[model samples]
Target: MKFLIIRFSSIGDIVLTTPVIRCLKEQVKDATVHFLTKKNYCGLVENNPHVDKVIVLNESWELMIHLLQNEDYDYIIDLHHNLRTWKVKRALHGVKSFSFNKLNIQKWLLTALKMNRLPDVHIVDRYLETIKSFGVVNDGKVLDYFIPQKDLITKDDIPLSHSFGYVGIVIGAALNTKKLPVHKLKELCDKINFPIILLGGKEDKIVGDEIAAVNEIKIYNSCGKFNLNESADLVRNANLIITHDTGLMHIAAAFKKKIISVWGNTVPEFGMSEYFGKDQVSSFKFQVSGLRCRPCSKIGYKQCPKKHFKCMELQNVEMMAVKTIELIK
Candidate 1:
């Protein structure tokens, strides 16, 4: 059977869908797995061995639909169940489709009503459940991130200070609410005794510079210099990872790196935490408790809704640094 797995955008959410890809390709008899994603994120899965072909949602929606209709897939696994995905399923109307339940109502309850109706299962497990009818199960493995040979980093790519080993800090998030403020990041950097590498996209270069300026010798800002796979290589080489609830965090989990995940407005209970399947990789989450306004949105905001911003301002950076030290040692 041919399976077309759909997850259109973003780094982390697409990374979370790897398990389903693996299971579908491995367990399902003679399965040919085709993945559909936005043009920007085609790099995340284009090199994946499990995917037979990658279909891009390019500038032409008509072209995208034209490409999908030609595949004649046996089933569609909709990992990202948005209106757009609904349209894709509609275009392939006759194909049997299994969609991953997004649990928007449960998310609304937690974020808005402060009611916990969400299942304790991780989003990965929930994603896999979408294909339960096919007898696909979690293979007890880490998330998959395949870096092309050309994109892999060499020792000369990093500074001598971090050449031996360093802690990887993901300094940017999709939204500001999910990020540790620049001040907090600087504080965390100041406290860590180990060599550190600040990672992010071009948009984060200024902030990365600000944080790296805390101690130029100890902190090397690689933001904006490397592409996504190169950044993943940096995360792969790190002695430890200190990150926000971002895509690199998921990539670090893919490498089974010891991760110190810092949370602000978002919580791990949303099931987006670092998942190692049955592997017992050391992972710690730091979030300020007792903040009623926390998780104000299912995703995140540009800034804290509550002016106080206590969800992040109140975090214990000292402890996060201490944990980094402990884990690195």
Candidate 2:
């Protein structure tokens, strides 16, 4: 069976859909799994062994549609049930497709009125639901992130301070409100006694440099220095990871690294947590509870919708660092 699984963009969301891809391929006989994603995120799924082919959606939608039309897939699993995915499903008319419920209304109600009507399920489980009719079930496996041999960073590539083990601190998120303040991160770093590697994209390099300058010997700034796979390689090698609600957090979960994920505008109830199959308890989440304005956005904002920003502001850096130590111990 030739299957076309569509999840357009973004790192974490795409990573969350891996279980569905793996199960559908391994369980269903002769299932040739093809994935559709944005051109930029090609790295995330390109190396996934379960996927037979990765169909990229570049600038030319017409080209993508034309390419997908030739596949003659047996089923279409629409994990990213957005407008573009709807268009893809429409373009491939007559092809049977199953889409996961996005639960937009529940998310909206949570963010709008601070209500808690959302299902108590992880996004990974919800993603798995898309392929339920195929008789594919969760195989008690966690998320998968494969790193190429060429992209692997060895001990020589890292500072001698981190030769034994290091804590990877993912210091950036898609939105500013989803990230911790520079000073707050520095405070957290200051409290952590072990060697720290600040992880992030090129945009976060300046802040990484600023933080690394505090204690150059103990902290190394790898932000902007490595590509996506290389960064994942670092996460794969880390003893633990301290991150915001970002892509690397999901990647760390893939590696089953002890993670202390900080929350800002978004809450973990939206079910995008660090899932390592059933009863995945090693990971911890830190969010300021009892704020009426918590989860102000389903995603996040450039700045807090309400300038108070107490959600992230109130998190105890000391407590999080202490927890990191306990987990690593």
Candidate 3:
């Protein structure tokens, strides 16, 4: 069977589709798995052994559609559930297509009214539900992220004394509302007794540097300095991970590293929390309860709706500090 799986963009969302790729390749008879994602995210699944081909939609879905039209795939697993994938299914006439249910209305209800009537399923599990007809099971596995051998960060990369131990902190997210404030990050770092390493893309470097500058403890600002896989290697080696709801947080879940996931505008109830991991001990949610303005957007916003930003502003930084220390110990 030749299967084409589709998930368009974003780091964490793309990473979350790994289990579907794995189960399809392993469970289906003579399965050849292909994946379609945005060009920027090609590296996320390029090295994945379960996937036979990684096709990138480089800003032009028409070009991708033109190429996919000729492949004559046996199955089209639409994990993205967007207009583009809908078009792809139409073009690939007669091919067995299974699209994941997005549950947008349920999400809208929760975001609009704070009503919690949504199903108790995680998004990853729902992704797996699409292929149930193929007799494929989830195998109880979490997401998979395969870093290229060259990207692995070795102990020698750090100081000889602290190389064996360090806390990996992911302080960046696509939305500003999801990120922990710089002051709160500094407080968390100060409370952490172990050596620290901050991780994020280039955009986070300034914030990371500012946080590093104020804290007395040793903190390595690796943001913008390393590529995605190299950063994954750092997360792989760390004793524990403290992250916001970002791509690296999902990657840490892939690595099964203990995570202290900090939440802001978004809640774990959205079902995008860290999946499969051993000793995945704790998460810190800093949202102010009973704030009518909370969850103004299903994803997040540039700033709080009320402008007070109490959801994140009112978080207990001292409690986070205590949790960080406990995880390290």
Candidate 4:
């Protein structure tokens, strides 16, 4: 069977789909798995051993359609479940297609009413459900990330002291509201006894610098200095990771590193937390939290609706720092 799986952009969401791809290829007999994603995200899955082929959409849906229609795939797995995937499905008439339930209504209730009716299942598990008809089952593995050898950052490149141990701190999120404020990050770093390595893309370079500036402890600013795969190597080698609910957080999960995931506008109840990992920890949720505007959105915004921005502003950074210290020891 030839199967084509679809998920467009973003690092974490695309990473979460890896388990489904692996299961379909390894568990099913005579299965050849192909992936469809944005042109830029091809790197996320291109190095993956399980996927036989990767089809990237270069901002032209018609071009993608033309290429896919020629393949005449046996099955189409719509993991993204967005409008574009719907169009792809419509065009591939008569192709056996299965789409994962996005559970948007459940997300709405949780975000709108602060009620937690959503299932306690990770999005990866839900993605696996799409392949049940093919008699494929999850191997209880979370997700997989493959980094090319050339992209790997060696210990020689890092400071001699940090070459032995350092914490990976992800300082960037897609939205500003989801990030821990700069001052709070400074506090978290101040409390940590060990060396720290701040991780993020070019957009986060400024925030990373600010956090590093306030700290007396040794910290390396790796934001924008390394490519995504190179950054993954840093996460893979870290003693522990302190991160926001972002792509690198998911990457940390892929490495099974000890994670300290901070939350803000989005809650873990949305079922997008680190999956199938050992020694994972979260700082965003608390029963003592008596705030009505906890989860303002299924995703997040540029800034909090309430000017106070207490969701991230009030995070227990000291306690998280203590946890990071303990994990490293």
Tell me the lDDT of model 3 at 262.
75
Clashes of each: 0, 0, 0, 0
Best by lDDT: 1
Give the per-residue lDDT digits (tens) of candidate 3, residues 1-329: 89999998789998989989999989999999999887799999999999899988856767777888888899999998988888889988889899999888888888898887778888888889999999998788768999988988877776564587888989899998888778878888877777889999999999999988865358888899899999999998888898888899999989888788877788887888888823444544445687776666768988777778777778777787677777667
Error of 4 at 92 (Å): 1.3
What is candidate 3's CA lDDT for residue 111? 86
- Please, what is the whole-model Cα lDDT of each candidate in the order they appear? 0.93, 0.91, 0.84, 0.86
Per-residue lDDT tens digits for candidate 4, residues 1-329, read 99999999789999999999898889999899999998789999999999999998756768878899999899999998999889899988989899989998888888887778899888888888989998888797768999998999998877787898999999999999889888889898888888999999999898888888865358888898999999999999999888888899889888888888888888787888888633434322321166788888988898889888988888888898888887677
Clashing pairs in 4: none
TM-score, every prediction: 0.99, 0.98, 0.95, 0.95
lDDT of 3 at 189: 82
State the local distance difference test value for candidate 3: 0.84
Report the Cα lDDT for residue 147, model 3.
90
**Candidate 3 lDDT score at position 46:** 95
Q: So what's the TM-score on candidate 1?
A: 0.99
**Which candidate number would show the highest TM-score if scored against the true structure?**
1
Candidate 1 residues 1-329, lDDT tens each? 99999999799999999999999899999999999998899999999999999988878888888889898989999999999999999989899999999999999999999999999999999999999999999898989999999999999998988899999999999999998889999999999999999999999999999999999999999999999999999999999999999999999999999999988888888999999999998888898998888788878999888878898898899999899989888
Sort by TM-score, best first: 1, 2, 4, 3
As for candidate 2, its clashing pairs are none
